[model samples]
Target: MEAAPAVLTFSPSSSSPAGPRPCRVLAGPAPRRARALAAPHPPRAVASSRAPLVVSSPPPPPAASGTPATTPAHAKVDRSGRFCSPRAARELALMISYAACLEGADVVRLFDRRISARREPGYVFDKACLLSYNHMSFGGGPLEVGTEEEAEKLTSQNEMDSANEAEVLSAPPKLVYNSFVLRLTRELLVAVASGWNKHVDILDKIIPQTWKDEPVARILELCILHIAMAEMTSKGTPHKVVINEAVDLAKRFCDGGAPRVINGCLRTFVKDHVDNTGTSQAAESKA
Candidate 1:
């Protein structure tokens, strides 16, 4: 993965609001923060792919009525490569602690060995996770969930390609890049340094920082913000979403609470903010 350019330093234009804010560019795996808060505005020129915030969010969920998330027994395996009864509990106990740094080299070896080891019940899932981390060595960000949405898009896209094959394929070169989103991704990695045991590695250098930059400190802030967002969300998706679905998700995940809070908050953000996210190819050709 190419290194993102150093953050552009500038005093806010008079039009911009004033306050403390996390780096708007961080966009890697969602960091777990000690708390969460509204971040200051992003640079309107950055063209971030995250849709601009629009609507007001719904009220956050009330305190829970004391229920626990249950993990199944088969999910846990001992270091000896043997399964234990009461699996869920044991797995939680043995699992890597929060922010545990299972290094890049060690991660590669562990995955290679685990994949070749055997076919356990959840072995495939475990293998996928390890392979994913390896890819992070090259590219680390949210792994897209290949759901029905993607499948339908893929099929339609494929059909269009087949029909258009007759057209001349040659075209002038154009850089396919989103500087903002890429920057967001790198900043997130720095904001949450999970590749080692609280140690900075090659990733830090790739993402250049200003003269006054602290790796561990920034990561902590990112983690706090994300965690607080989840908690305030009643453990639902914190991202802004379409209206009805946002409400429904909150209700389902928040143990049957009012759904409007999530919806309102998301709607307000999208409505109020301006954005410069990259357009899909469809939009570009039309332009």
Candidate 2:
């Protein structure tokens, strides 16, 4: 028999002679454990060497209690960007006339003095007052600011109005009037001065006995009537407009039934003077 082939028996501890050994996958968790050991640890948050970016927002403003919030009423302005509203001019004229009545001075003269008065030396006007000016006070009312943009707009408008008001009502009255306003005010003052005696006679016939008895107390009301009559007689403004303005002035400056009394008085005056004049003109045209 050929030499018996060399038989090799391998035991667990015996090393087998081979060119390449097959990989033996672990049946249990050994391979998994090895993988776990080899796997990288998840990244951890570390303190940055540089300053970290931070983001923050402003705190919400405290809400007011009780009062309902309302937006501030915008003051009416003309196209000229000045406080030259006819109403404003009327108000100024009324104020001047009232002052003249109190001072017993000429209305135009008083206005001229106020317009020409010099500022005191070393007197600094606080511009910040315009921005910080708040018509509302603590417990006064609530403000309705819908958005940041709206709030900014409102604030800007309010500051502008405050500046205008300050200029108009400053000590010695530094009014920034446009040409129309200046002319209208001067005309109103001139009309008032020229027609004072005539309107006084008319008012004696038209005004109530109570007003007649207390002319000193009714000076403002009388001034309104005088302005309306003078303006109407000039035929520059419509009688209806003049009457309406007079009624509005009375409503603003007078208390209680004064507005109604003024309204009625103006209607009577218009009926007597305006209507009669129109009727006469019509009759003359027909003739």
> Where is the poorest 10-residue window by lDDT in model 1?
168-177
| C-alpha lDDT score of every prediction, in listed order | 0.25, 0.52
Query: Which model scores highest in lDDT?
Result: 2
Write model 1 residue lDDT over 108-208, tens digit each, in one string. Answer: 22222422454446422222221111100111122232354544443443334322211101110011112332233233333222222211221232233
Candidate 2 local accuracy as lDDT? 0.52
Please report how far candidate 1 places residue 18 from its true position, in Å.
23
| CA lDDT, candidate 2, residue 15 | 26
Where's the lowest-lDDT run of ten residues in candidate 2?
24-33
* Segments of candidate 1 deviating more than 4 angstroms: 1-245, 256-258, 274-287
For all predicted structures, in order, the TM-scores are 0.19, 0.55
